[model samples]
Target: MRQGLILVVFAALLPVVAASFLQGQSALEDARKLAFERMIGTASAVAERQRDPFVIGQHLLLVHATNPDVTDMTDTCDAALRASLSSYPPITNIARTAADGTVRCSAIAFAGNINLAQEGWWQRGVSAKGMTITKAPIYGRIAKRDVLFLILPLRSGDGRQNGTLTAAIDVNYLRRALHDAGARNAGTLAIVTRDGKVVTDSNNALAFKPAMGAEPDQPIEARDKDGTMWIYTLHKIYSSDLFVVYAEPRAQLMATAVAQMRAGMLLPLISILLASIAIWVGTNRLALTWLRELQNMSARFAKGDFKGDQARFERAPEEIAAFSADLHIMADVIDRRNTDLTQALEAKSQLTREVHHRVKNNLQIINSLLTLQSGRVREGAAKEVLAQTRARISALALIHRLLYEQDNGYDRGEVAIDNLMAELCLQLRSARRSMFQVELTCHARNFPVPVDYAVPLTLFVVEAVTNAFRHAFPAGTRGAVHLNLDLQAGDAILEISDNGIGYSVTDEAGQMGTELMRGFATQVEGNLSIISSEGAGTQVILKFPLPNMSITNAPPLGSVPAF
Candidate 1:
């Protein structure tokens, strides 16, 4: 129930949480887009400033190329180049080279044997009629510094190349120009070549190598050599092969937006947490407490305790109070019904026992009559028949007596087969004629069976043992009669064997006993087998299934006193 309440609260608050998250994400995206635009603008400004030095150098070279002193390599040409270099701090040197690659004039002094014959920029300049710039910065031999060169072709009247005019712009001056332009920006600024070379950087501490594949005017994130993340953009510098890079730390760029988003989301999260707590507490107080009390009362009722107090639920809700009242009424009804059933069961059990006692008394009377009749008979055959009849009657009487005699709490109608067999063996021993010196030994295990099963089983044992007593021992031969009842698998085995002079089945005297024993075995759904020979002893074995009932209360094997 508490979990259900929490689920309800969570479901109710889920939409608010989702909406806040989406709104914060949208705000964050907007902040990032604005930051990207500002950084692009700053980069464009720096690119423009970086282009200025190259543009100024091109214009100066064009002007100087037309002067007579510079073209003719007059005595004042070196002085003229020096004056131009001093005026533009970014231009490190100005020089004029002859078509054959000899240096005719230079602002910076060097060995006169130095030639521009094999230089790539000079060869290209001599071939082209227009101004040209170097692809990347190079170390200037005359200026002794890293520089980018601008070249102009000097031509004769027929348009043949006369010589070339070159100006070397210092790399340090380009870096200063980049810094001045982006000083107000938040991060590093740099000028890079088309092939990802860093020509000049405002902050050398960071790796300013911009990606060559990056599109211009767009921002992308990159990690530097020191594992710092940056958001930077690239802008081309005015048709030149150089690019300006503006970069800022990613954390700084998104800090304000992240803070705002977190501030916006905090309240809703706290509200959900508090609401869940309230629901949990409120549900326990209002409903679960009363439900728990009702549960306790029901458990007690299951254990037959119906004396739980109902007044304790008077202050509960109307539904709970009414439910408690109903449970109390139910408990009363069940208790009364249980008492009535118990009384009726006891009365039935007593009547059944009384019936068994009367039957046993009547059977014993018949047995006594048979004994009297056997005593009067003079013929040997007639006396033997009467004695056998009396033994059969006595067996029946014994079953009834066992049924009624049991004071144990188990059903009185059921007979313990082990006890019955032990008693039967005792009776058989007592009844044996004095003429036969026969010993009887009984070994049986306990099995409680209903009267229906007990009757046939007891009779079967008696008939088998009696047959062995009469036939197996002849002329008063000393022998033993063994009766055994054992349990194996799910079946019970009853064996009656004797060590005496055995007789064949074809003999007239044994036929009747065999048929009678077979009938008894069929009645109890058992299989009967007789093993006998003319000289050896006989064994009558009866195998039958035990009744399907609890036998835990039955005594263990060898527990019953055997005779």
Candidate 2:
């Protein structure tokens, strides 16, 4: 209860804290906007100043290019290059290159005769018709330090390239200027190239580092290494592929928010504390104990133990008492219905057993009459047909006997398939004991067979067995007949084979038994195959789908001579 109240108090205080925090963020944003504008202006002014030295050098080269008398490339441009270098000290060197890949003039006297045709700066300048700036500062082969190149192509009278004029500007000069501006404004500044390279930063050590998360066209806010909030703004430099970054840190940004929220919530916090105490005491005395007991009772109800005689809810609130009474009424109704349903199920089971018993008795009487008629006939095909018919009838009668002996008649009474086949084979073998000495081996899996499936299944096996008994072996011949019934992959397989005189598979005569076996198989949606040879034994196989409860109609119990 105390934990819940504490959480409630925390939830109530959230909006106040959030409002104060948003207010402080607003102030920081305003300050950042002003700082970003100032930094951008500073960067623009610095970029213009940095371009001056290169512009002066290029102007000096343009003067000589327009003069007609100054046809000699090196001698005419040497003095001008020296004069420009002396004026702007940041420009380390200046050079004029001829069309034949020769550095014709230089501010340094010994810098002549250096070939610059293969350099990236020379290639780009010769192709560019106007002023071009290097995308990245390059290390000068002669200057031995990083330098930025500003190239101006020298065009002749026909606007064709004659040679190139190049100025090497010191990178340190721009870095120092940016550092001074950052120190004065209490922020950091960096110049980044378009390809995410930080060329220089306010701290001299951060050169060539990966650029921070600043898009070239917008401003973003983030935190620095010391958890100080900083806003970064990006400004693209005019006439160049470089971006200038301005970052300002608001050291006490969140601290002011936290302090304001604490001061404003002083009265609210005390009031919440007193209210929480009163709520705790009142709910404890009025509802908490009874509510806990009610929760336990609900748990018991969910588990089907709805007898709530032990619940002491009379002293609780009127609503709680009324709810308890309703629960008790529902439980009483459920209990009485359960008892009445059990008694009805018992009565229905007894009636079903009695019905199956009478059916078995009537089937046995039919089998007895067939037996008496077979005995009166001479030993010929007529008597043999009666005997086979009687065997089939007896097989159907055995199914009902098994169903009558079941413990549960309402659960669609199941029979063990292996046990059923074993008992059937034993009875069939005993009936033919005097005719021939035969052994019937039954192999099957034990599976719960529903009554509907059992009826058709038993009749199908009976036809196959009797067919083999009549045709496979002759009179007074001892032979072994094997029966294998197994359940595999949701199909029932019944196989019968006999080591007796075989017949030709091509012979189509005496097909009545074959047709009868086929009909029984089709009734169960099964397939039948027979293999017979002139001298070898015969084998019969029947494959059918597993028995299900869909066979509501009882199977034909009499002989199937016409199939």
Candidate 3:
């Protein structure tokens, strides 16, 4: 009974404890104000130093132009006054005009010349009242920067109004000085008139907003709707309506508000009770004991065993729903690819046998025609024509025989370097009626590739070799035909050299198939170089990069192809 009474007393006292914590908020506000005031104090020190004396002198000069003695619209006194300003120290630019709005004389840097009659600041200075200060304007091509010019009416010994004195103030220097004062350069110091004309800002020292004319009701920091306290303070410059404002955001200013709130925690039971209710309403996963069979169904789908379907995706946790959708999409793609592969194989099989049958029948008919044509012709030209026709027909017949011997057709039109060179020599021997003998030597290793990749490459090699035989070793010259083929850097390399009274390789290579040889190489996306050294026989190296050789792993090249 005593313990229960003690617990009740503690709960009842928690509100009072929280209220005591709120009371310290006033102290936090005091600290914030002190810190902001310190920052403003620091920034003001540097700002004063940036106001150059030359700038201050021009300010007085602009105001002096309003004096009545300035009646000479274009007076020599204006020139004398300007010369005096330029001759004096701390002044970069100066201009003055009479109260009637006429520029009298102008002086700038000792080495500078500026026309005051057409200037905006000159006109404004002439029209300004006693102590009017104009917002800085970006003017003049000389230094072409934004500057605030002060205008003060000149006063004679009797206190009469004379011409005005104008002084140029560069705001860019003032802004940078403020930035150097703080960490973020977030402090803002403004020289405001009775109106809200923000004369100078720490950020855009030279920037003057168009609406900086005047403000009747200005912002003062205090509590917002959230009941947070803010601090805003203003200091009026001595003997002037201009106020310098210093302020900061309340939330940012108060550093100790959070520590005080945490130290004030009195009761944890209420917070715990609220947490339990939130957990019960939000969680409904398997731990809630809602679905057992659905788990088994999703497990099978995840393992890619989608055949035996179990429960639908109705009871899995929200996190697993996206995965379930992906399973359905994959099943559709696999089924479609399988059907396409099967149909394509069947069509390919039927077309292969048909092509073999038609090619064989065409070769047999051509051979019979050549035989009959040779019998009727008696002239040497007629017999040579029939002989050439017979040789072409035999080559076509060889193509058919190879096709029927393989299910893959890889050995049909496609030929490896070793096998291709041997076959070309045998066929050329049969086709040539000359007395000279032709020898074929093939030196190459097993370079595996697809038929599409090998066929065109072999055709290019065949053309290069034949051109050597028919034209290179002419007129019964007993010499050797050399063929060297290799593979390097995903490319098929072949070198065909011939030694047989080889016509100055340079001149002979320049004619006939030498030109056609380039076209044949391009057919296979390969390269052909006729590297023939004078009488040392013609040597041709054909480089063809094989397909599917992993170009991604190819060595970095010094340059790119023309294409």
- Per TM-score, the best of the predicted structures is 1
For each candidate, what is the lDDT?
0.82, 0.69, 0.53
In order of lDDT, best first, we have: 1, 2, 3
- Which pairs of residues clash in candidate 2, taking residues 3 or more apart in a chain or in different chains? none
Q: Please give each candidate's TM-score.
A: 0.62, 0.47, 0.34
Clash count (model 1, backbone only): 0
What is the descending TM-score order? 1, 2, 3
Candidate with better TM-score, 1 vs 2: 1
Off by over 4 Å in 2: 1-9, 16-321, 408-410, 505-510, 547-563
**For model 1, how does the per-residue alpha-carbon lDDT over 428-461 read when each residue is reduced to its tens digit?**
7777856347778888887678888888887887
Q: In candidate 3, how many Å is residue 233 off?
A: 62
Residues 318-417 of candidate 3: C-alpha lDDT, one tens digit per residue: 6444555565566556556656876886577557756766786788788888878888999675695576556556655555544555543432334333
TM-score of 3: 0.34
What digit string (tens of lDDT, one per residue) describes model 2 on residues 1-563? 76687678768866765665566566655655655566566656655655565566566656655644332574556776676667676778777778755777777676435787888767887789777767678887656679777777777778767777777778887788778766765557777766657767786333223344455444466665656566556666635456676665544323454455455555466666776887788677667877788788878877778787645887888877787788778877876787788788777777777787788888899989988888899998899788878888888878777777865233468776766787788778776776557667777666667876677778777766776677667877777778877656778788888787877755664377678778877877888999988668788898988766332233322111110
- Candidate with the greatest lDDT versus the true structure: 1
Q: Is 1 or 3 the stronger prediction by lDDT?
A: 1
